[model samples]
Target: MPKRTIVLSLKDQDIEKFLEYITQRLRGSDYSLTYKDGRIYLTIHGRPREIEDLIRSARKAHGDFMKIHKPVAGVRRYPKDWLVERSRGISLSLLIRA
Candidate 1:
């Protein structure tokens, strides 16, 4: 089944690199990635476990870029559970380090 909607914000210049990295990681996976309203909305079609793995891997592997783009103050983190609400049906809300 398709995963819940996820919106990612990437500066114009960063989009290329982000897409390159994501594509490489998800080489065999099918997903919907689009740019709209200055955000990259991605919907991954996979099992819940698969989605969890993807999110964890992305946060661990590609998170370096996230660090570079973080705010001047405070820390950036991913919650223990990406699923924010039961009604949302296991949605992963990705807040880019920006």
Candidate 2:
């Protein structure tokens, strides 16, 4: 199994839509969603293809309210170290391992 991460920038009006989009796709999946510092962060445990599909769907569904950025994939790593360095805002950082 691999881990994937996605970062999305959204306006106040679009947060609910984004959450709905994710909830629809990620039903019964091993995933986590969190909002902090004016950003939406999604962490999922699944295949690369599935992850990509989820991101694409999310963008299409919430495109009007949110500006979806490109997804970043890589070897799995702990976020604690990176979080410490980032400013008081949420950004997308991914760690994926085979």
Candidate 3:
């Protein structure tokens, strides 16, 4: 199966709190969290159901934060190699904005 990625952009928000919340919500799931270019990347290599569940958790987190902070947060998905391209010095700013 193709890999999947969930990209989260949180501007002017509490990173620690968001990380803790997402970590708790995604317990037992196959995922890795990383920070790069001012964004949080959640890379999931799992079954489709697992991916769906993760997306739901992300939405819940978004909603929870929206109620409290309403910070500039964007939750997006991208091809598995999006990170790879970024790492290889590719400009994805255009893609990101789209």
Candidate 4:
């Protein structure tokens, strides 16, 4: 089954690395990724279990450097729609530490 799209935010520092990490983790799986408005959008075709696993792994890998915002399950939509519907006051901010 084709799962719904999910949106997640990553710290600027983790953007590049996280993309690589996620791409590898999802290898041989049915998933698509794109970035826009500073957020990464993931579209996967699989059970929620697999998707959830990806989320957990991502959180663990970038726990200290990234922040993730997930939508309530069963709400199906693309990233843009999810953002508008959820309307969480959350904002993506990137801080550079020298």
Best-fitting candidate, scored by lDDT: 3
List candidate 1 segments past 4 Å from native: 68-98
Residue by residue across 1-98, what tens digits does model 1's lDDT show? 75855667668877787888678766786677899766887777789888777666655534655554454468654433322532255334443322
Task: Tell me the whole-model lDDT of each prediction, alpha carbons only.
Answer: 0.63, 0.60, 0.68, 0.59
Residue-level lDDT of model 4, residues 4-97, one tens digit each, is: 6777875556678777767665678777777887787887777889877866654454442332332347442234322443555554221112
In model 4, what is the error at residue 50, expressed in angstroms?
3.1
The TM-scores of all predictions, comma-separated, are 0.56, 0.51, 0.59, 0.48
The lDDT of model 2 is 0.60
lDDT of 2 by residue, 1-98 (tens): 88787777766666776687568646777777788776788787779887777667555544532323223373233334333444355543432221
Clash totals for all candidate models:
0, 4, 0, 0
Number of the candidate with higher lDDT, 1 or 3: 3
Per-residue lDDT tens digits of candidate 3, residues 1-98? 54577788875356777787678767887888888776888887778887887877776765565455543455444443434445566556655554
- Clashes counted in candidate 1 amount to 0
Predicted model with the maximum TM-score: 3
Better of 1 and 2 by TM-score: 1
Candidate 2 lDDT score at position 76: 36
Candidate 1 yields a Cα-based lDDT of 0.63
